[model samples]
Each structure stands twice: as C-alpha cells, then as structure tokens.
Target: MKITYLGTSAAEGFPAIFCNCKFCNEARALGGKNIRTRSQSLINDDMLIDFPQDTYHHFLTSNIEGDRIKHLLITHSHSDHLYPEDLVLRYGAFAHNMRQERLNIVAGGNAYDMLSKTEQHGITLLKISPFETIQLGDYRVTALPARHAIGTGALIYVIEGEKNILYAHDTGFLFDEVLEFIAEKRFSFDLISLDCTNVDIPISDEGNHMGLPNIRRLVCRLNEIGAVSASTRIVINHFSHNAAPFYDSLVEAVRSDGFIVSYDTMTIEV
Candidate 1:
C-alpha cells in the first residue's frame, strides 16, 4: 500500500493565514516541508482520508488525478477536514467522467448530515459506526471513535491490505474502548500515522490533540503489546501553529526520540 501525506497542519495551517509568530515567520522563509496545509491523506491514489479546503491545492502540488479517487473517508465535519461543499464540484454539471464510476464517502453521523443536505452526484454516503468494519475494494476499514468535539466523532481507520495501517489522528489519546479493541486484536500494523498536534505543549492528559508525552506513552504501549513490528513505522503529523517547537525543531525532537515526523507531500510505501 502507498500512502501520501497531502497536508499535515492543524486548522489554521502553518505560517497561518495571519499573525507574525516566530514559528510562522520561520516556516514562511523555510518553505517546502515547513509549509503545511490543512490535514489530509491519499491511500494508493484510490482512497482519500479527508477532503480539506486545500483539496485543489493538494492536487495541483502533488499532480494527483482527483477523478481516479474511488473512496473518500471523512474523519469528521471540521472545516479543516471535511469540505463538503467541494463535493459539489464532483456533481454532474460541474464534473465530467464522474458519471458511471461510484465514489463511496464514509463518514460519521455529523459528516453524513452535512453531505446529505448537499446535492448528490455519483457519490455514495456510508455512515460509519464505531467498530463497524466496511470493505472498500481490497481494504477493510474499521472506524473507531475519536474523542473530539461533541456530536462530531472523528475516526481512526484500521486499513488492511498488503500492509496493515492504523490511520489515527485529528484527536488526542486513544479512547479506552479503542485501546481494548486493539489489545484484543491479533493484527499488527506496518504503519501508524498519529496525531502530534501539540508536540511541544505539555498537558496532563491528551484532550483534543496529542502532545509529545502522550505520543511517547502511546508508542511505548503499542510496542509493549507487540502491535508494532521492529520495522513498523510510526509517523506523527497534524501540527498546530501554536505548537511551541515549530517544524524543524519538532522534527528534531521526534527524531531524537526515534520517530518519523510527517511533512506535506511525504510519501511512504508499506
């Protein structure tokens, strides 16, 4: 399986829209990986994790074929994650060649409500229930509950293919149920893309996002459970502009701890 990191920034994005913070200034000057857009990811060019407002920009920058995407899995209805209005562009009148091909959009209740109100095109909406598994082509995806906004359930996807991956993000620490589920499961993941939004910020407990300490704890637990292989890859992404240690500093920090930090446009094969 091939995974592509489309964007890795939190809601406001790195270097934000406005503000003159030191990190923002540095990110602007450094450019490249330092410049992150809203969070999103593409799997094997056929499935997309989230459709952020930066969808168009992601396509332009990555030179990806948007029409070829057969599945869209939205983690939540947050503006940074689900840009439901963009789906309008895929409708009959706006887009050609999207006629016969089916586009399956998997999301939670809130996301479904948002998509349902919009005009349907060739898209099929699937309301994801916590722990319910859905098969998409060769991948079997299980959506786990994310402890985020009320009524807005974020998803942590367990994607099974040539490699198994836990696409966990947009939320803080794993829920107890999710942890127990994984503990009981025999399957191990080749990759785990986790939320590292508050990498530099210290928190008693992971709330809406994960900090370095929480991430370290999670990693240790995964390792202890043998859920991660020696070659298993762990990547941290979805950074907030408010994170004290900015891009390069954060990368160094994670690297020092022996973990990979995801950047915009970063690709990994599993």
Candidate 2:
C-alpha cells in the first residue's frame, strides 16, 4: 500500500487562517515542514481519504488528477474534511474529458445531506454506517464511529487491500464500542494514522479531539486488543498550530515512540 500525506494540519491549518500568532509567524519564517494545509490523504494514488477545502492546492502539488480519483471517503460533514461544493465541480462545465465511470462517495450522517446536494453526473453517493464494510474500488472500507462531531455522528475508516490502514483523524480517544468491534473482527492494521489535533495538551477520552498522551493510551489499548503490534507503523497526523508549536519539536517529541510526524507530501509504503 502506498500512502501520501497530502496535507497534515487541523481545521485551521498549522499556521492557521486569519491568525498572526507566534507559531504562525514561526511557520511563515520556517517555510518548510512547518507549513501545513488541512488534513487529507491519498492512498495508492487511486482513492482519497477526506477531501478538505485544500484539495485544489493539494492535487496540484501532489501531482494528483481529480478526474482519476475513483473513490472518496469522507470522515464527516466538517467543511475542512468534506468540501461539498468542489465535489460538484467534478462534472458539467467545471470539468470535462473526465473518466467515464462515476466517483463513488462514501459517508454517513449529516455529511450525507451535504453530499446529497451534489448528486450530479459522474458522482455516486453511498451512505455507510458504523461496522458496515463495503468494497470501495480496490479496498474494503469499514466505517467506525468517531467521538468528534456528535451532531454529525462522524466516522473514522479502515481501508484494507494488500495492506490495511486505519485512518483516524479529527477523532478523540478510541471509543469502547469501536475498539470492541475491531477486536471482535480481529482486524489488524499495517498502518494506523491517528489524530494529534491537540498534541501535548491534556485532554480526556471524551473530548472532541485528542492529544499525544491520549493517543499513546489509545495505542496501548489497541495493542492490548491485538489490533496493533511491534510491526505496525504509527503516524501522528492532523496537527493544530496551537498544539504543535514547532515542526522540529513535534518530530522530536514522537521520535522516541517511532511515530511518523506527517508532513505535506510525505509518502510511505507498506
């Protein structure tokens, strides 16, 4: 499996929009890995996980063609994750000479309402629920309930093919129900991308987002359940400017744990 971290920042982005904080200033001056866009990932160059508003910029920089994307897995209705209007741009005057097949859009909750609005040509909307597994393009995708966005009943996803990936961003600590479900199914992941929105801040499991400490506890729990082991690659993604004060510090913090601190355009193979 080939995974590309197109953009690795939280909702407001690493430097954040409309902010001139010290971190933002630092990121501006650093102008390298310190800079980040919204959260998004491209898998094997065929499927996309979370279409943030930054998709247009990401596609260009990552050398991804929008028309070539066969499947799109949205985590929720949040504007940062699911930019509905752009999905509409796939057809009609906005796009032409596209691939003949439809783009399968899979999601659940209120995100369905926003997605339902974009039911145009070359777009197939498939609503999914927790624990439901469906074949999406070349992978088996399973939706798992997310602790974030209670109003939308957001989800995190597991996509399995030659390798398995647990894509969990904008999510808090693992829910007991989700953990039990994975445990019962005996699903093992080759790579686990977790939400590090709050970084080192103190946060509880019930919070809408997670910090590194919460992430560590969740990894331990997942390991105990046999879903993760020594060989599993742990990646900390979706960082916030407020949480990840500096890129070098963030990388150094997770160095001991061997967690990959994702950056824009970082590609990994499993």
Candidate 3:
C-alpha cells in the first residue's frame, strides 16, 4: 500500500492561520516542509482519511486525484477532519463527470448529523462503530476508539491490506481496549502514523493529545503487545507550530529515535 500524507498540521495548521509568534515566523521564513496545512491522508490514491477544509488545496498540490477517491474514512466531526460543506460540491452543477462515481464515506455516529446532507448528494454512507470492521475493496478497515474528546465519536483506524497500516491521529495514547483488540486479531502494522500535536511538550499521561514522551511510552507498550516489530515503520505527524518548533531541528531530533517526521506531500510505501 502506498500511503501519502496530503497535509500534516494540527487543527489550526502549522504557522496557524493568524499568528505572529516566533515559531510561526520561523516556519514562514524556512518555507518548504515547515509550512503545513490541516491533516489529511490518502491510501493508494483511493481511500481517503479525513477531509479537511484544505482538501481542495491538497488535491491541487499533491498527485492525488479527487474524483478517483472511492472510500473516505472520517475520524470525527471536527471541521479540520470532516468538512461536509465541500461534499455538497460533489454533485449538481458544482462538479462534472460523476455519472459513475460512488464515494463511500464511513464515519462514526458523531458525524452523522453533520453529514446528513452529503448522504443525499450521491455519496454512499457507511456508518461504522468502534471495533466494527468494514471491507473497502481489498482492504479490511477496523475502527478503533480514540483517546481524545469524550463524546465526539473520535476514532483511530487500522487498515489491513497487502501491507497493514495504523492511521492513529487526533488522539493521544492508544487505549488498552484497542491494544487488546489488535493483539486478539494479531494485526501487525507495517506503517503507523501517530498523532504528534504536542510535539515538544512532554506529557506523562495527558488524555487529549500526545507529545514525544507519550509517543515513546506508547511505542514501548506496543512493543510489549507485539503490535510493532523492528522492521515496522514509525512516523510522527499532525504537528502544530504552537508546539513543534522548526522543521530542521525537529527532523534531527526525531530521526535518531527511528521516527520519520512527516511533511506535506510526503508518501510512504508499505
């Protein structure tokens, strides 16, 4: 499977929308991979994870085809993850060449209310609950509970295909329940993309988000669970200028620890 990170920023984006902080200024001046948009990813150019407001920008900037996207997995109702307003443009006079297009959007209950209109716009709705496995083409996708917001129906996912991948974002550490499920299923991930919103801030057990410390702890736990191996690829993404400092230093700091810091438009083969 070819996993491409279309965008790699937190809710407000790296350098943010309106900020004059030193970090933001540094990101602006450094340019290149330092500048990031909202978080979004594409698997094999067909399966999409999270449709943010910057989806249009991602489509334009990356090699992904917007029309060929068949399955879309929404993490939550957060606007940075699920932008239903743009789904409205998929049909009617807003878009063209959609006579054979069938976009299957899968999400938790939290986003159902917001995506009700998009369901009627010629898109197939696949409502999936935590632990429920759904098949999309050749891939088996299982939704897992996230450690973030209490009732927002946030989810992390493990996609099993020719190469398995764990796309865990917008959440902190992995829950025990999810780890047990992975163990029970014997799901070993080839590539794992974790949430790194709090890049520099060290957290012992913060519930909402994760930093480098929590990520190290989580990886150690995953090692104990046998979910990850020596050959497994570990990537840290979903950064924020408020926390992550600069691209060059960030790269140097995490590279030695076996963590690949993702930048926008970076693609990984698993």
Give the number of colliding residue pairs in candidate 2.
Answer: 0
Identify the runs in model 1 with alpha carbons over 4 angstroms from their true place. Answer: 244-246
State, as a TM-score between 0 and 1, how close model 2 is to the true structure. 0.97
Tens digit of lDDT per residue, candidate 1, span 109-157?
A: 6887888898777789988888999998888999988867746766778
User: What lDDT is obtained when candidate 1 is compared to the true structure?
Assistant: 0.85
lDDT of each: 0.85, 0.89, 0.87
Which candidate number maximizes TM-score?
2
TM-score per model over all chains: 0.95, 0.97, 0.96
- Model 3 has an lDDT value of 0.87
- Among all windows of 10 consecutive residues in model 3, the one with the lowest summed lDDT is 112-121
How are the candidates ranked when ordered by lDDT, highest leading?
A: 2, 3, 1
Question: Distance (Å) between predicted and true CA of 156, model 2?
Answer: 0.3
Model 3, 1-270: lDDT tens digits are 899999899889878899888889878888998999999999987899999999999999995567788889999888889888888888779778964388888999688667875546768888899999999988899999998786888998999989999999889888888889999998888999999888878755657778888888888888888999998999999887788556677788888688988989999998
For model 1, the run of ten residues with the poorest summed lDDT:
91-100
